[model samples]
Target: MNTINSILFIIFFLGIIGTIINRIHLLSLLLCLELLLVSLFINITIWSNSYDTLISLNYSIILLTFSACEASAGLTLLVSLSRTHKTDLLIKLNLLQT
Candidate 1:
């Protein structure tokens, strides 16, 4: 259990670093965000293991649903940005363009 916790912590930090260092590309950012969510889901699953099965299952389902929604939204934003700008670089995205 300690090993698993340590591994998850490593993964979470790696995801944070990825998000910070890969700010140039929207795809990589999205992937890194997913990695963060996955690590969090794993941690929640492990933490909930000692509780009621139904409660843990509910938490898992909620997390999964949220992740799915987040991924879909990010993908749509990426597609729209790429279509309009012909690139997925975060630096080129002008969200407040007049």
Candidate 2:
């Protein structure tokens, strides 16, 4: 059962990497980030089960919250950018004002 869970976890982790590589929608990118967060959370929990320590799980939870905050802030900024310019394309965005 643990092996099965590990395999599933790995698959989802890779899926996030794949989605990022494909440069999908912004929302999809955020979803992939959340998926990665979950994968890490599960990994830390599984490690806690084996190592009998709570530190790893605690760290994972903290990082997950940080990632959530990052996603929210990034998306909010993206929304503001899109509203100002009416576009979400990175190539067209003057993010550096150059």
lDDT of each prediction vs. the true structure?
0.90, 0.74
Q: Model 2 over residues 1-98: C-alpha lDDT tens digits?
A: 57957786887768677675746355566667777777776777777778889788788789778878988887997798779878766557656885
Candidate 1, residue 84: lDDT: 90
Q: Model 1, residue 2: what's the lDDT?
A: 88
In candidate 1, what are the lDDT values of residues 1-98, reduced to their tens digit? Answer: 68999999999999999999999999999999999999988888887885646688678779888998999999999999899999999897778996
TM-score of 2: 0.73
Clashing residue pairs, backbone N/CA/C < 3 A, model 2: none
TM-score per prediction, in order, is 0.89, 0.73
Model 1, poorest ten-residue lDDT window? Answer: 50-59
Which number leads on lDDT?
A: 1
